[model samples]
Target: MTLLPDPIISTWLFSSVVFGPWSNHVTGWWEKKQTHSKLLYLFYEDMVEVNQITTSCAIKMLLELEYSIQVRGRVQFENMKKNSFVNYFTSLAMDFKISPFMRKGKVGDWKNHFTVAQSEQFDEDYKKKMKNITVQFHTVV
Candidate 1:
């Protein structure tokens, strides 16, 4: 979850937000998109297509934000896939008994999780929610 530095202080929930959202919890990156034109939204599944390049882009983004050398080095995409993300988030979910933050982290895991009906529902909801947005989903899977 990340928050914008506004007087209203809109908070956006990433998928990793364990408990989901609250009453006034801001949803999506809409605010971020509007406020920070340079923001890049990355999906984990898309990273499967070009892990190295996407990781480099992420590192470059963090570098632009002046991340400390240690933090930057630790955030390498391979490390995120193996140690930093899966193990750490699995431990978090185990500690809490909720769905793990690292839910497979694989492209097409949705096919296993979502039934046809569920997938249709998601598609409809996504279409409605993202009506005017120009986001792209990878098709290489």
Candidate 2:
């Protein structure tokens, strides 16, 4: 599950891809229903981090949960470690100019996009909506 960015930067993309079809309400409901074991939530910033370790861990969990595959010692595991699919897919996305998907894939990019008022409003709304949700996001990229 992809996480929404902090309200500061999220306002710019809130109505776009960031929260395009899903909201915290929907995600919270799903998280409650599935519980942590069945549902793995991943943050985009973490996934695109400098080392990509978080992304690798998410991929490993997906393989284990969805396919019931033990990632260690598997061909799929080795390929993922080498980021074969991720590299290829990123290249394709770059070729297509999918800016939202590829642009400045980093943490704290919201600092570059959001105004103070917008950020405060988003924070208020986020706190109200996500108050009961137990899942927390990583603040660092």
Candidate 3:
């Protein structure tokens, strides 16, 4: 069985925590749709899409934008793509029988799991909840 038995519940909770008010406050930019000099909003999909060959360049640019610091060398970037960090973390999670931090790591994986009715319900609920929110997600479904 998948670690996340209920994708809806898990997705809701993850979204609520990651994109919720708390995260916005921490970043100090989400509430205000306009870009802040001090805050750099970096979406994982955006970064990956910007350069599919290597996310290092995108990540470096984001860091520079956020901290105004120069990130030197390709070593760190190569390491980031190696999956060593993810493997280590996932191994720990496995030892504890906890949900894996990294699942399929593929975009639009929900299409494989969510039923038609469930997808419709989620979409309706999402639209209603996000109607007043400025942040938008580029979802596949």
Candidate 1 or 3, higher TM-score? 1
- Find the 10 residues in a row with the least total lDDT in model 1: 5-14
Candidate 3 Cα misplacement greater than 4 A, ranges: 1-29, 32-36, 52-97
* lDDT (10s digit) by residue, model 2, range 1-141: 233455634554355443342355456655775655746565555544533465456556666544434343232333444553443444342453334333444477665665666658667766776676665656465
Measured against the true structure, the TM-scores of the candidates, in listed sequence, are 0.56, 0.49, 0.49
Model 2 misplaced regions, further than 4 Å: 1-38, 48-56, 64-99
Model 1 residue 14 distance off true place after TM-score fit, in angstroms: 17
The candidate, 1 or 2, that scores higher on TM-score is 1
Q: Whole-model lDDT for model 3 versus the true structure?
A: 0.49
In TM-score terms, candidate 2 sits at 0.49
What does candidate 3's lDDT look like per residue over 1-141, in tens digits? 232346644465346543343333533456553655544555545544554433444545456544322333322334444545543543331452344434554567766766666667667766765676667676542
Q: Report, for every candidate in turn, its global Cα lDDT versus the true structure.
A: 0.52, 0.52, 0.49
